[model samples]
Target chain A: MSPLAAFGTALTALRVNALRSFLAMLGVIIGVAAVITTVSISQGAKRAIEEQISSLGANALMIRPNSSSRGGRRGGFGSGTPFSDADTIALRDLPYLAGASGTIGASGTLVVDGINWPSDVEGVDADYFDIRDIIIEDGRAFTQAETEARARVVLLGKTVERELFPYGGAIGSSVRINNIPFDVIGLIASSGQSSGGRDRDDIVYAPVSTVRSRLSGFRYPGVRDPVNAIWVEVRQGYDVETVTAQLTDFMTAQRNLRIGQEADFVVSNFADFIRARNESEKMFSVMLAAVAGVCLLVGGIGIMNIMLVSVTERTREIGLRLAVGARPRDIRNQFLVEAIVLCLAGGLFGLAFGAAGAYGVEKIGEFAVSIEPMVALIAVGASSLVGIIFGFYPAHRASQLNPIDALRYE
Target chain B: MGALIQARDLRRTYRMGGMDVHALSGVTLDIEAGAYVAVMGASGSGKSTFMNMLGALDQPSSGQLIINDIALHERSADELAAFRNQTIGFVFQQFNLLARTTALDNVGLPLLYSGMATKERHARAAHCLEMVGLGDRMDHHPSQLSGGQQQRVAIARALANNPRILLADEPTGALDSRTTQDVMAIFDQLNREGITLIIVTHEDEVGAHARRQIIFRDGHVLEDRR
Candidate 1:
């Protein structure tokens, strides 16, 4: 028999037992739904993390002072000798460097119109905004002259602006940080939340010179113009790894550390960090999809059970067909088509259910869930495969029946 | 004319509880084209086995069985299936019509294996149903039809492929005597049209309608007469 004719027969049989067919497909439906929902949500989270990493500057690198051990007592990172202004100047002059900024952070309460709010005040150079991709939504960024002359100018993050100046006009406003007056020069654009669940817009920016000399009072022993960390941006077309290696070598040489002596600094690339995070997330998603795949397999087994039952129940019909000239292949094709059609139908419904489930998750849990087209296609393909894999045995059994004995079946 | 069916010492044996049970042993017969033959026997008389062999549904052990010039033992199972489709029509005592399907579709089932188009299959099925006096009940399902009508539908299905041989195993066993006569009349009409017919039954009344009768006893043909 033609495959189309066999398919028609299968469709007719399924329609005759519509409720049973649907019940048989329920396992596949739930299985595909679980797989699609889990994969899409994880992919969405991965995409969100990538965006966060890119916002921090795709080519940016963080150079921090490494923790030191004194008498077997290891202090935390940044507890050792911090980067000096000379070290920042030396790294800034590298040929492949786009720009570099030194930052010194201090937690202080800012009083604005009798509203006091606790926030981090970051000391930064004029190049900090460019390195961090922090665009000004209103007012201008800090000028080089302001950084050099230690002017009391500050950039307010969106969160700080909202808290301190809820009624707009945050630009040109005067706010006291540690009782020192500073002019708000710009409003930093919001960058949403970081992957670590920290608010990215809760801090304020000011000139590093003004912060170090007046507000923070931080000066590492034997270090001139002590800074907590240095933000480095690689020039376009220059490999980040190459620039990172150059900077590390330059820093180590300038520190005058002997051979086998651990350097007191570390250079970390944001891109590498993002890649590592993506890899872990992908592994997690694959594990989740594997669990969901087991559910689909269970569902496929359900289909096989039903198909076997159907073949047994229709033995007399099969015998009649055989006597009427149906080839064994015809009987086999009919049952196989029935199974595949069931799975395909279940997959379609599962796609819809999975999409709905993803949306529901996003709404209830406030998590990202993206339904990529490729994921849907893969899911449907997998379900069809499941049908074929599980549907073969029963179809083969039905095809191998002896016509005489089958007809004699009561 | 050459014999339509030629069997030489046909034998069929089965193993039941590790013992040989001969369903058909050393049976030989010849049936000509357009002949109406009745195969009669009591239960366990090997009549059904002989009928199954003649229908190409089973192969006889250690015997040469030929039908329409094709040796049954030499053919593969799949080849036999195709051979059956092209040469034979079968009607069982239970009618064996597919449930929940319309009489027309059930009748057209054999044509599906022939790769016939839907329109042609329907047309042939309709013509066969008309021939069986069931043309008006084409859309009715088996459950909706009476036992006699269901049997008629089964007969129509058997004729869908225009097979040369019609094989019926106790076709009227489940019907009332009035309906039995009705079914026999249809068979008699089909036989008059020069189609070879073989009917297996235990009832003498059913066998009396055939032009020739062969009786089996204990796995051998005890008598054959016109």
Candidate 2:
């Protein structure tokens, strides 16, 4: 018959079995929803990872000492002296070097006229602000000469400023770090928070040279204890790996470290972090796909069972159709369309639920949950296909019914 | 100018439980256009088998049978289905309308197989119901209609395709005398309109009403008379 006629006839039959048709469609809806939600969560996780990693810095590379021993046990956390002023100076000489910094942090209290706060006091130089995208709310960072000369100067994050110097306009005022007084030279603007809230405005900065020379006495232990990793900025379009290698080699030589002798350091550029996130995203995507696959399989089974029941219940009906001149495909298509419509409607329902689910999880879970349009499209498309594949055999069985036997089936 | 159905040396045999059963034995027959014929026989005399072959629903084991210029035994399954839709209509002893569908939808079923448009299909199906005196029952489901009414709806469905041949296994077999007369009158009216008809029955009265009668005994035709 004409496809329209086929559609009408099929629809009429399905309508006659309204409750049964709805039950069959319910399975598809659940399947589609499961697929959509899984993919959306996986997609959200991937985006979160990328956002976390990309926020690090584009032109910056980090080098931290690998102090782990033979076991899972970690060593002194750094050479305690692997990174030094010599390495920082050498970094400045490189062609692609945009900026450089060596850090030395000491957790201590900062007090300004009895307003006190627990703060992390770290040594920083010219490149620290740019590498971390640290903009000043007021005033400016201390100069290189000021830092080298061991001037009593500091940069205060907004939170640190509020707690240690709540009176406001604390720049150019003195604050005590570990009871050692330093002038607050800058107030850093507020950065909200990460999923981990690691970047809150609650810290300060001093020059690396001053911390090493006057504060910590520059004892030359393991090249210079890294309060933490150092950040090195490269010029735009510069090969970060080449710069990373040069920096590593220079540190190895300056520190008199042996080749493959556990160079006592690790260097990672922007590309490395991005590559890591992409890998993790791909892995999660595959995992979500597998989940969707399982859902489709279950959904298909539901359709098959329902269609089998339909074939059995309608034996006489099938006989009548055959007697009335229905071709095999006509019979097949009628049932197939029923199955497909069930799946498609379910897919639409799933899409709605998935989007809401992702949003709710993101809000309630206090974590980023993502849903990708293409992934959702695939989920829906796959659901319909599953219904067709699973519903095929039952439709075939119904089509193959013998008119004589069916007519007498009573 | 032509015999609507022509069978030459036609035979139909069946295997039941690994044993051969000759359902039709060398039954040669010719039926002309616009003739209302009744096939009468005792049980297992192969009257049903003969009707199936003539309606192009089954193949004869030996010899050729032609209906409306096409070889019945030689046609493919799909071609036979198409031929059935195009040239034949069937009414069973017990009315066999689909239970879930409305009378209108039931009548439109043959047209559904023929791929007619929905609007035209519905219009023609409604018209067929009107002709069968079921115009008011167009929206009724099969369960809602009486036995005789259901039979009338089946007849309307059979006529929906404007088929040249009408095959009734036992048209009045389930009806009371009053309903039987009404159905016979409808059949007579249909035959008068120039459609060929074949009715298979065990009833002498029903057989008597047809213009031609073919009697079967032991899978062989004993007599054919006008």
Candidate 3:
């Protein structure tokens, strides 16, 4: 028989037992859906982290003080006083250094009229906004002169803006932070949420000099204007690791620390950290897809089982066909086509369900999810492969049945 | 002209629990084209085995079988299948129509296996159904039809390829006497239309309807009469 006619016969046979056919396809449906959904979610998360990393600043290194060993007792991370505003200014002239900024932050309550909201108040240098890629939605970033003069000007993050200025006009308004009034110079644009699920637009920014002199009283008598951390942006076309190694050497000599000594500062590349995270996420996604592939294998076996049952059930029909001059090849083709149709149909349904599932995760779960067209194609291809692989044995068995014995079968 | 079917020393053996069961032991026969013949025998007399061999559904262990000028015994299984498709039609006592399919589709089934296109296959099936007086019942499934109508649909299916020979094994065994007569009348009409007809049955009344009768005893032809 022609393949087209055999296909038609397969379709008719499946339609006769529609419920059983659907039941046979259910495993494939779930398998493909799981694959698509899990891959989409993981890919979305990886992309989100990539975006966050890029937004933070490419070729940027963050230097923070590590635990200080005092009297042979080690403190937690960022416990030393190794970094200050002077160190940040000294690093500005280093090779491949695009920009440098020092920042100090503390939790404080902001009051506008009678309303109040608790948020992190960060003090940054004039170059902090440019180095961090922070966009200004209103007004302008604090100028160099403003920072030198210790101007009490502030920038509210998007989330802080909503909380402080519900009726608009927050750019020129006066808001008191920890009972000290400061001029609202600008509003920072929304940066959305971080991959870690933290709200990125919920803090406030002010000049470092202003925060040190007024809010956080001077601490160290020897060093000038101690700061919490230093952010350094590398110039374009410069390798961050080379620049980082140079900066570490510079800091070590400036602090009079030797190689054997436990240095009080730690310098890290932000991109490396995030890329490591992204790689792990990708590996996790692959593992999940592998699990889904196992499910597909199970589904293929289910189809094989059903095809076997169908071959047994239709022994008389097969016998009749053989008696009417159908070649064994024709019978085999018919059943094989039936199995492929079942799997392909299931795969299509699975694609639809997976797309819907990804959408649901994005909407209801508030997670990033994106489906690739190639994933859909691969899913379909895999299901077809499954059909061909699992359907072969049963179809061969059906073709091998003796016509006389089959016809005489009860 | 030469005979349409010729068998020489046809033998079929089976191994049953370590013993040889000779289903067809050296039987020989010749049947001319357009002849209506009945192969009558008691059970285990090898009449059904002979019928299976004549229909090309089974191969003889040792013999030569030529049907419609093609040597069936030497044909491969696939070639035998094509031979059966092109040169023979079969009707069974159970009226083995595909259960959920319409009478027209059941009739068109053989044509489908012959790789005939849909439009032509349907047209030929409709013509065969008309010949069987079942043209109006084309859309009816087997369960929706009476026993006689089902058998008629089976006959229409057998005629779908317009085979030169028709083989009916106990065609009226499952029907009432009235329905049996109706079916026999159709067979007589088909035989009169110049198609070779072979019926294998134990009933004397059914055998009497054929133009020639061959009775088998102990895997051998005991009588052949015209």
Best by DockQ: 3
Best by lDDT: 1
* Candidate 3 lDDT by residue in tens digits, B1-226: 4699999999999999999999888888899999999999999999988988888877889989999889987888789889878899999889888989999999999999898999999999999999989989999999999999999999999998989999999998899999999999999999999999999999999999998999988888999999
Candidate 2: how many backbone clashes?
9
Q: Candidates 1 and 2: which is better by lDDT? A: 1
The lowest-lDDT stretch of 10 consecutive residues in candidate 2 chain A is: A218-227
Superposed model 1: Cα runs more than 4 Å off:
A64-87, A94-98, A104-123, A133-193, A196-228, A234-283
State which candidate, 1 or 2, has the greater TM-score: 1
Error of 1 at A119 (Å): 9.7
Instruction: Write candidate 2's Cα lDDT for B65-144 as tens digits.
Output: 88899987887767877887889999988888888779999999888898888899899999999998999999999999
lDDT of 2 by residue, A1-410 (tens): 77666666667767888888778777777767777776777777776666555456667788777675656655676644456666777777877878878877667778878777887777888688887677887988888799779787888888887776657879778888778888887888876565585766777778877776656554543544334567888878887778788888877876688887767787877657666767877887788777767776887888789889988888888878888888778888877877777777777887898788778887888767777778788878887897788878888888777666776786
Deviation of model 3 at A155, angstroms: 5.5
What TM-score fits each model?
0.83, 0.81, 0.88
Model 3 agreement with the true structure over A173-228: per-residue lDDT tens digits: 99998999999989998998886788989999999888888877746657788888
Fnat of candidates, each listed: 0.82, 0.49, 0.74
Instruction: Tell me model 1's lDDT, rounded to 2 decimals.
Output: 0.90
Question: Model 3: DockQ against the native?
Answer: 0.71
